[model samples]
Target: MKSSILASAAILAASLEPVAALSEPLQNILINTDRSPIYRYPTDVTRGIIPIPVHSHNDYWRDVPFYTALSAGCISIEADVFLFNDTLYVGHEESALTKERTLQSLYIEPLMSVLKKTNPKSPFVSGPTRHGVFDASSGQTLYLWIDVKNNGEKAWPHIIKALQPLRDANYLTKVQNNETFVPGPVTVIGTGGTPLSQVVSAADRDYFYDGPLKDLTGFTSLVSPIASTSLMEVVGDIKSDSENPLNPTQLEAIRKQIKAAKDKSIGVRYWETPGWPIRLRNELWRMLWKEGVALLNADDVNAAKEYF
Candidate 1:
């Protein structure tokens, strides 16, 4: 019986060797050949990436604005736009602004181009599709935070005008009849110096306002899908050395603001978080996630991506 068992094991092992030998060469040929059976979808650019709830704070500061955040699987992006001669220029401040890098050049056009590729006019597709930038989650609407600088009333109009191409493509999310909401590939949110009166007054607008995190009296997801505020401002200085980074008072403040936003179905994001003392940063991130903060404001998406 022992001899028969040994013979059976030997036969099984011998059979597996031929299959292993065949697989390696086939894999190599597939890797080298153009005729490989692997097929890709229209928006396979972000095929393997998993979308995370991190907001890429000051996204224009990155080497490649939109593409960098998109590649890192960041669902939110912020751009500081300064209106100059009716052209919306993207920069952190007036000194950084240049003629070459307008909102159209940096964000609007690039997003349109990507959307065009994703929503290809192919016979295989049944109808018009509004697939977003992330192929992993086609329905995820990217938050495009436009921080209007200086003249908001003036910049606001130019920002709207610059979004024409995306508007034409039906890519901007809309709130029709001041009530009915329609989700699209991109959700343009007005922050910084953006005029609240202008945003709320519009009976039918494609854009939204970045509501105050602490105050959500009249704002809802209709006007502000996501609300934001500085963590330092709201919670005071975080004492990171201890087990509980945030003191009792600071934790309560955060919870109150988050609860207010949650009550109105609005997402919450806190910026100006401490980036130093790696341990503190990680601890804060963990606490925020545990406490149900909708989006994590991350200056370093690479680190945030790894943390998630």
Candidate 2:
């Protein structure tokens, strides 16, 4: 009887047709909850979703793909892309791939929708102003980190082609005359096996390369807006029991890596941060944030929000 009631409620919500496409969980929530207090339109709910500095790692695996991260106020999100039969499938593993969850459908469409609502055609504004992802603060650009799981050179063209809607709408951050960078609603950074030569050689490209955090003396902000390295690799090992975790050597290495990235006018991020031994994990997170890391890459964004 309860299942029938929820089913009937879901059908009713679907029939009404909310302004934005409802994710599976959201539809279920609407089905179960009282409709009186719910927002009339789905887009109305996004107005309250503020953008945060945290990055959502493995974002596609979540219940609602993009909406899950956005609802958590994550300004940065990652998508692991695999090329299969000339189509980009968004998934963590090969077995998880699906026909319906293409990069275009899961990321591009939803992004375009949100951006359209955020940056509406208005007469009040002047020539042009860059709009960010959040309704609360529209100046901060959302970083779309694309981790190419296969041949990046072969996959580059497809990714560029997929960004057509954003490109057409002038939503991508662009480098002016190979010198000045203008941050827009979305800044796509290609990482993990993405070729540096291809990224650097593109004289007129919207996408930027993720520079190596350990080797950042060569590149500047124009080509690489962000630099990243493995936390474990950098610091050697992290101990949960110790209060004074990082020794002199480890501290120096971290400072140098961070300084190198900062000196180039670029942002820095570290992956695979310690997760267990809760106290030490929090301490490590604090150390990174305090040292001026641009985006704190976190698999668990809720914990990150609280860490901040």
TM-score winner among the candidates? 1
Compared with the true structure, what per-residue lDDT tens digits does model 1 show for residues 167-233? 9889989999999999999999999999999899998999999989978888889999999899999
Q: Tens digit of lDDT per residue, candidate 2, span 58-148?
A: 8998888888788788889999998888899999888999999999999999999888777766688875555766877788788998999
lDDT score of residue 189 within candidate 1: 97
Pick out the ten consecutive residues of candidate 1 with the lowest summed lDDT.
34-43
- Cα displacement (Å) at residue 155, model 1: 0.7
**What TM-score would each prediction reach against the true structure?**
0.88, 0.83
The whole-model C-alpha lDDT of candidate 2 against the native structure comes to: 0.84
Deviation in angstroms for 188 in model 1?
A: 0.6
